[model samples]
Target: MKYQFDKDFLWGVATASYQIEGAYDQDGRIPSIWDTFSKTPGNTYMGHNGDEACDHYNKFKEDIALLKKLGIKAYRFSISWPRIFKDGKYKLNEKGLKFYKDLVEELKKNDIKPIATLYHWDLPQILQDEGGWSNPEIIKYFVHYASVMFNALGDDVEQWITFNETSVFLYLGYLYGIHAPGIKNLDLTLKAIHNVHLAHGETVKLFKNSNYKNQIGITLNLSPNYPYSVEEKDIIAAKTNDAFWNRMFLDPILKGSYPEEILNNPFGNTLKEIIKDDDMEIISHPIDFLGINYYSRSVIKHDENETFKYKSIPQDGEKTSMGWEVYPDGLRVLLNYIKENYGNIPLYITENGAAYEDKLENGKIHDIDRINYLKRHFISAKKAIDEGVNLKGYYVWSFMDNYEWAEGYVKRFGLTYIDYETKQRILKDSAKWYSQVIKNNFIEE
Candidate 1:
């Protein structure tokens, strides 16, 4: 097919620790912020928690078998920070480390490259009690945690992600209080954002300087911002929204400085104090690649009453089960934007998939909508690559349906259907189609 990817272009699937690894209390593993947040009344959908998730911790072999069946080249999974630090004291949890070593070994045996992520929003509850990401003191602890993982799994896991979706966790956790360690304080949110960026930089430096011969990077959930109207005010609103949503996080890492427009903006002014001498230098350490999670674009309009002065307007188009717009071309726009602004840095669509109201029929799922979503997005990615963007690979958002934070088990984003009750995973029609894509290394249109 004309939509073929390069031979080296990796195809993979991703899953987070809290979402899939259900052995929450096993092997001396302690509670993560998710465990605490999900347990609280009215925190998650129908109060559903990830107490048993997909039981991947216990069924990884089965899951990996399914992954092998899909003919993917790599598997991107995160380490449960709490699992390794069980006591929150930075003490080595050999048992916890062993689990990941085993997981990596299994992936390797199956000829799948293991892309390990250090943190996926599953901070130990004990750390949250000690101010979590908001407190600068947590940086040392995070670095120590990274050091341990590097020493333990560096040999087996060649690709490492320092953090996943920093904007989502920081915004939802600190500003909106909709996530773990939830607190609705603007000051705390700014502090958490700065600290997390600092933590990522420090960790990247550690990994790059080490003798592992592996690659390290961070994953960001990014979207292209568009104006709701041709009016200058609306255009300015889109720019402001872009500054807040995209540049605030991107500039610090790629350019070694926060975007000037955002730094002067009212919502971002408070970050100036949180930023310290040489902090930006540390936050902008060079990395091997950039992981981008693109799902939708934001159409913004000026709203003087809003805190950020830009409000998101709902678009008239097809939307996924998660209420996110299905704008595949946004992937091309976002990738090209990165290339144009950030230079030709290597990039990966680390997490991109649509959630749909999937149902099981006759022991199978017919998720044509999800298939279409993925196909269009893949085509967009191919277009960007053909246009000279250094787009490297694509990993579907999830391997199977798990505990979707806040929304809980309601939304299904998996190529494989997970029967939450029986824990039986049946390959959806989309999975069958994706298997062929991976097998052919192309989108067969």
Candidate 2:
């Protein structure tokens, strides 16, 4: 094993509001899209909802204790918009505010850096009533919401992410109808993407204008797309997939414009109309760092009649419990691509991990597959750093097993497995392995 990371590289784990922080109805917190969608019949798998996910809301201190025990240097978590603003307005939810305040303080007390995310796909139901991201009004609301958190916790938290995977939210929620506020409308999906970019721009502007002492960035789930074949058609399919999945968000934020390929497509003009003057400047505001969430590489082929004209094919390799391919090199490829395309901005692996169905026996979860998945990817990350990619941190996808959205509780992506029925948490073998990595700042054979 090599000590390739910087001495101060962040080691941590991440969790979202709707996925882990239950108490959905308590403390003046209003319903979010997840709350509404999960409650609706036949929406979530097996009629499951995150009504009491991991009970993190009530046990954050204990959770932080686990992070301390794991020797993690940072913790990235999302702030529930509906919890902070029951109606998406300034009427403060004292209890909701206090919850996060205390959580941050606890992390700080344990010498753990806190990375706060403003939104993680948990839009307040009130905002959803008014077209959600499809309406431009969300820009102002999101800015205000960001301001509130900045004013409340900026002193302690030095790393801030505006939106966690906005592309996923728009695509899944609006296009695929898998997540909350599910609606399968292509036109609306495109509109929602534009609105989300605008909202991100507004929030970035707000953070800059406030003179906050912190770094602001966006976390994007980027995959290295591979064409199914070397043929010209397959190559063209790969380019299209990159334009939509990777460049659609990256180009605008990093280059201040949409990818030319996407802008020249049949729906290109529609995207152009949505991009307003000065929007790019707001979106591209000089940030201190960018967060990349890499899971697997995508193998795609062209399909003219198919939506987006690129269909994902299964990879001929090992798979995670979630059925995603295990491709550590994809992480290295994406890291170098960002460095070449987006300049030398510092980057963080804000979310990386695999799901595994591990059965606990004798009071322990011997999840060897997850441990191997993490070790291989961490080596890939080390390779990136050795190759001069200014990588800053690595945070596993989650700390505790909780309600996975859409897939429900079926997919477990945590170091600590949560018995949903008993609310008992058992640390898996991966947790112990990760603890050693964090402690030594390197993996040992």
Candidate 3:
């Protein structure tokens, strides 16, 4: 069966500032937590940092040209905080702001809608030194930075995402010690999660009052949790894991509340200290839409020793180079679940694509695997739309391969293959496939 998305569906590609924009220490931009972490002794793969990644900071014009050629109608990108606040938290570096302004203008000139992400895990080093997102005061700082962006670039942007994957940054940073400002502590992680909710609420309130408003929302990387077995223990564990990862983030924003289990769990005492009474009302501020970043789903099994009493069960199937299982049907199931749970709120597949071990061949990349992966997912998206899910748009994981973080530059997720040494781009077979999808508003098989 062939299907076409609604003509108004948003078709675009996304990239983060730290992942692509090199020139890390130039134009008065100081070190972000990522910059410091990548340079540390044993954080990322091969000691590879994003110092000269994709060189997108300098090559943005060429990149914009790529987007234009792809025929995508939208481009989603993040702004680096250190670039704008070079001196301190409040300092406004015009050069840093101008870079993004110029990017926005160029995007508009090319007929692309600009969707701006306020924070994509690039916290200014100064803020991390001052306790980062763990401190309640950090909420104020985030709101201030958001205000600055709103006043400067908000008018040019049609959509604004306050934070990209709050769960990944907080969970990975606080419990895993893999990401920046590394701190692997359970209590601190709990506290940080609450503060993050507060920061989200505060920022949404600011956007509501701001005059420049087209569409505003948050992007979450969600994995549907299914039980490893039909056993009671596994089912309970799966639900608990869902509550922690999905409900923990969504309930606060959509329902204006948190799961009672999270508040009353073994970590109850720790959560109480940081959680405030008036926080839910603030966090629950209504928004225009929700952005979902889906990659893979997980099968949960009960494990008493694990912190959450749950663990992921490995399965036999096609997996990404990142080792995540590729399950396209999960996309439709998840889309329907969100709508059933959150009431008809507008939704966008903000990020959905896979990373593969790709290499150049003769002037182009024959990435048929990526094309197949996206075809299945796009089919699943059409199913959701047919079932009446209000899926507004779809944006691929990335436009081009750049820094992969933690794994560093080793993994490739871009539809466009990048020649790292020469900073050249080759449109992979997946890119050509995606171009047709955008050009026709339908996935052509």
Candidate 4:
């Protein structure tokens, strides 16, 4: 069976600035929250830092050649905020600006569209020092940053995403103390969530008000929640999980309102008090598309003694290298749910790939598991499209292996394997499979 997509359907790969672009302090680049967080003792796994990630900062041409070799139509990369504003102010860094400009030009030379992300969890440390996303002033600063990028690359870059996975950043960084600026406080996390939504809304408005001819949207790590049982308690628990994880951002952005169920949780009333008039209007900025990064799903069951009063039950199924359950049907369900609730907004699978223990042998990596993982999800995505989901693109989570955040370099989620010691990129079997998929523009089973 072969599934064909629209001729213009985008096929791409994604990587973040800090994850791939090493040269942490080079060319007037300042420290970001990741830098501070990783440097602090006991923050990151194995004390891993992005000091010399993939050296993409210096070898961007080589990376572009790789993308061209893959026959990719688009490449989604992020711009570092601290690189643009060294002091976390409106002051532009010419060297940092020129680096990305050169990269974008190189992509254009290869006929690859540059899908630029404004932020990808690399907030300037200066902003962090000033309360970061918890501060309302950060909204203005972010808008200014967005304006600078829009004006700089607006002519060439046609696809723009304001931020990547605010929920992950807020919940992990603040609530779980796992990522940057590690703080374990729910109130601060909630505050950060509010401010990030505000910033995203403001940035979207800024892009719309600009003279750029492009599509603007935001990317979210969306996972659909399923009930563990048909029992009433389990069903209600699933609903609550949906309100917390999915609807928290989707409802505000798509429906112009936060989920009433969220406000009725233990902290619900307090959250309502924190929400001000017109905030929802700001968050409800019209977007050209919604980027969905789906990997797996969670089954929820009622738990009276659990921290959130509901527990996520792991299905008895195969798991990924990251310990995430492998459930491809969840992607179809999520896309269908979004289509039904979000009014048929154009959507893109911005990041959907699995991590597997990749082993390099004889200068080649045979990651059949990754190939199978992607194949299953691609089929699921195709099913969603066939069922009338407006999915416009599908980008693998990573093009090459680089830093894996708190887990450091342990988890490999890339089609190309990287030698951390030598910074060498070796195309794995999955890369070849993915390239073939791009060449055909459809996967055949």
Per-residue error for 308 in candidate 2, Å, reads 2.8
Clashing pairs in 2: none
Better of 1 and 2 by lDDT: 1
Q: Against the true structure, candidate 2 has what lDDT?
A: 0.88
Model 2 / residue 345 / CA error / Å: 0.8
Off by over 4 Å in 2: 1-3
**The 10-residue segment with the lowest total lDDT in model 4:** 264-273
Under the 3 Å rule for N, CA and C atoms, how many clashes does model 3 have? 0
Q: Which 10-residue window of candidate 3 scores lowest in summed lDDT?
A: 267-276
Per-candidate TM vs. native?
0.98, 0.98, 0.98, 0.98
Ten consecutive residues with minimal summed lDDT in candidate 1?
260-269
Error of 4 at 435 (Å): 0.9
What's each prediction's clash count?
A: 0, 0, 0, 1
Estimate candidate 4's alpha-carbon lDDT, on a 0 to 1 scale.
0.89
Backbone clash pairs for candidate 4 read 263-268
Model 2, 238-279: lDDT tens digits are 988988889999987888888888778877877778777888
Instruction: Kindly report which residue stretches of model 1 are placed more than 4 angstroms away from their true locations once superposed.
Output: none
User: Considering every candidate listed, which one attains the maximal lDDT?
Assistant: 1
Candidate 3, residue 265: how far the Cα is off, in Å = 0.8
Tens digit per residue, CA lDDT, model 4, 1-445: 8888778888999999999899999999999999999988888788999999999999899989989998988999999988898688887899999998999999999999999999899999999999988877898999888888888888699689998987888888888889998989887777788888988898888888875778999999989998899999999999988888888988888888879887767776656767889898998889899999998998999999997779998778799999999999999999999999887899999999989999889999999889888999999999999999999999998999988889888998988888888888888999998999988888887
Model 1: what TM-score? Answer: 0.98
Q: Which candidate would rank higher by lDDT, 2 or 4? A: 4
